[model samples]
Target: MKKIQLFIFAILLSSTSVFAQSDATKKADKHFAKFQFVDAIEAYNKLIEKGEGNAYIYSRLAEANYNIFSTVESEKWYAKAIEAGASEPEMLFKYSEMLKANGKYEASNVQMDKFASMRPADDRAVMYKANPEYLSKILDKGKKFNVQSLDLNSNMSDFGGTLQDGKLYITSSRNASRKNYGWNEEPFLDIYEYTVAEDGSYQAENLLDGKINTKYHEGIVSFTPDGKTMFFSRESFFENIYEKDSVSNTKYSVLHLFKAKKGSNGFSEVEALPINSQNYSIKNPTISQDGSIIYFASDMPGGFGKFDIYKATLDANGNVGTPVNMGQKVNTEGQEMFPYVSSNNTLYFSSTGHLGLGGMDVFYTKEIDGKLAPIRNVGIPINSNGDDFAFRMNEETGEGFVSSNREGGKGSDDIYAIKKLQPLCDVLIVGTVLDEKTGKPVSGALTTLVDANGNVLASKPANTDGKVEYIVECDTPTELKVTMEGYESNKVAVKGSNEEEVAVTVNLKPIEEIITPEQVVLNPIYFDFDKSNITARAAFELDNLVQVMNKYPDMVIQATSHTDFRGSKQYNQGLSERRAQTTIQYVISKGIDASRISASGRGETEPAVDCKPCTDQEHELNRRSQFFITSGGPKK
Candidate 1:
């Protein structure tokens, strides 16, 4: 359930206690501020029964139920609050979320539309307005994974599973012997272990080592690559760390991460992480494959929401540095938790932030340029209109586990085994650069992978075989640009299927002209009738000569211009000389030496296609330019 709004609401309620006229209001406000939502709901309902309920009381009841995931109750109270003239934008937003959670999608969209109208500038509102049909798009994503409820799930909340060394470690509230937590009236969470047989079956579950499972809540656990070091979350009761609430006169213990070393019997040498603080909670730790960095969720100050994913460097001596927030790209003004990094460095996490079906949804992002790429929802069977989280995957085997609290489960939350049918947008692009004229490999050509907006994603020089490869998002508009010296640049669109490979061939035309004993041949640079200025077509042909001149600096060139038989000899000659001078100037502007170029005019005197009473087409073709190598040749 989302609690950041409750945290804000609690502070608001506590500060405005002086406005309370009834003892019942003060009593309920204190309970709500201290997170004793069960008591708060009872007290708030009592005021409503006595006909003393106002918009304030209704909003309080709505938020209290929302913090505890009472979907029906919260939805009911939110409607009442809105009807009672509660103008808080969050109330409408949460109302829509609760509607989605209960599978009332049409009602949800109605409420979301009202919320969007209220706060059009908010990211949530903007996203909704931009893609109101997001649900249909999400449904159309199809089933990317097949999910199966675990056989060992008990009639209690069981979630957050991680596998290592043929064992699955998960957190469960199944221990009836433990005292119940007031928040959910369930036994405190404890980390449990289950043996996995090679036959793809599970053995009986047991409590994790005594050193790790304490009386207070013991949440998820993660192991290092070698499985020699373990990190897990526990309530701060063991460390005697807590904060006292003035209103409820209660001392609340926050969750803190602890690290332990593996021994012959079990994990021991338990110690709290340095990032732990009594002021806020830090939990759900997952380490990278190299064991050099740890990723976790924290509610510490400076976070974007109730919980935000963070990473800290782990030194050789097992010391953790200051935590760094994963930034706004991966976090939002909602809870984000249960971050798992796959072997290939794809970071999978759960978020109530980013656009999703509903509740906390599983999202994945790849690392690009030491930062995260855009987040993508796993979609369909892997996510639902429920609190789906604690996602971890084995990329090599295409199997993984996820936890959810959707309908038809054995408990409030259950861990489900998932087999990936396909990836959302994993594509491998393979291509080769070749010469257009020769159909041979253009070795050492530079190739770039760019997005639809021309942003470069990756770039590299083609290998000796003219082959290049890149991994990019599928179904996204992308293009491959290839360039080589003495060759025209080429670009082609890249399209592929998810998790599939596609082949592309880029062909570049040669730009360098063949150095001949006489005039250098090039595409005809046609000039308009009676025009002396260089056109874009003329400039294009002149650029070829500029490239040739630059390639052979000592080589000199004579640019001669010709005209059709339509004009007088003197007039045509003057226009032709002007055209020749313009060509020389164009070449010089392209960084070629001016001294190596000379201009001349030949008016109707040297018509290669001589014809009496020529057609306009033939006369137009006669108005062209040619380049003759005056001195110097290609170096031997």
Candidate 2:
């Protein structure tokens, strides 16, 4: 549900008397704006039955339905409103969002484009214009985590988890002993405890015996590093506190912050923070690593959106400072909640305002050089079209937990264990290009960094100083390729690590020298045992030979293939012949005339490096291929 939209709609509720053209319209408009969807629908449909419906009435009906997540009803009335000549930009915008929520992406995009055309300056339209393919990009972010739903999830809602001393504390609405919360028709939320296993699974489940579990709705919880202090959320009603609405007969109990200290008799010293208010809900508390800061989400005054993340200074004396909104960098016009601060000062929160795959996606912002980096969505399956939030991470093991109401959960909302695929490392690669012959620096050489999958991660030209620098992931294997005009391309393999910066020098040899070398020596052309077919890697080296021969058409060459010492002379001769023939046919396939290329099998007759006791490396070198210029090529 878009609660911010609901808040604004509630203000429009007052306009019912002004817009009251008739008795039926006044009652319908008031109910619709006041969030009484069933009453609003009944009132509006009564007027419609009398043929009194118009664009305004249909739009209001659609908005009221939308407030309750009635996508089908919302879509129908929105279409009716449009057909009745309602074409406001905001109308179109809401229609597009409704379509998107129903997974009608293509149709939604069409309406989005129309809305953008009308309100070109709107931020939502601008974001759509800038990155229409954002969904695929998010999908292409690939798996950053492996998530598993906890088996301890109950039949009702179970969410918001944290681990301390091998014990997992989770918020759940599964207590049969408590009264059902009217909001969701589920039992009131309580803090359930489970002992975590060595395999990261949990066992020995029970309700927290401490004063933490309550009768009202409890949300998220966290503890300090030393485990001496704990911070958690509970509804103000649990403290016998609330503000009663006279007309609506609603008791609005805002969430409050509470602190407790550990004692030998379990958690005992429990008290509410000074920041609790009867007017606004302040919840989802997470503490900083050093216990100096307490970060939480609130719907208080002076915020950027419906709910904003705020940080309060926690001094040694237990005094809480004024709450400060995180501002535009993390907050937006939509809800941003569940602020978690890592040891490195990285902030993790859930936001509906930011562009995401859908719903509230978990995002993180880290500071670099006194500036906040771009907030990155943690990506799915940690995220989904359904509400996914309440994220906390253990940076040491690269494992943590997130709660989502996505499909396949044992409950309406289940806590998921997530482990990061890779560690975050700040490793830089400094590349140097030089001439192999003269050892002189070669400037402007093109450099490319490729991962093991052969995907190009980055590309740049070496500076005037023959240096090209690119950042890489630590403990990740990478290959650096360098090339320059009139020089043979060279590649070097390296891994970025925590200890030091990786330096690589690509020695570019002149093209002429690589085409015809004095020794006719290169990396061995490997053959699998008794197999003559060329592998992909072997074919790559053969392509280089084809390039040289193609440049000099009249070149005549001889190919000699050998066998290792394991095979008998007679068996080796027959096996090596097939490889020799295969080599000749490969060159012929590259447009070299069959008569210009000849091949022979050496069997075990010639040994480049003789060894009475040969190692695998030596045997591999022995089972090789040698190319020799017979005539009309670079002179020997």
- Computed on alpha carbons, the lDDT of every model, listed in order, comes to 0.80, 0.74
Judged by lDDT against the true structure, how good is candidate 2? 0.74
Candidate 2, residues 484-509, lDDT tens digits: the string is 76666678998966735778888988
- For candidate 2, the TM-score is 0.60
**Per-residue alpha-carbon lDDT of candidate 1 for residues 324-391, written as tens digits (9 for 90 to 100):** 99998788776788899988899999987677888888989887445466677889898988888889
**Which 10 consecutive residues of model 1 have the lowest summed lDDT?**
7-16
Best TM-score among the predictions, by candidate number: 1
Off by over 4 Å in 1: 1-21, 117-121, 428-473, 476-491, 500-636
Worst 10 residues of 2 by lDDT: 7-16
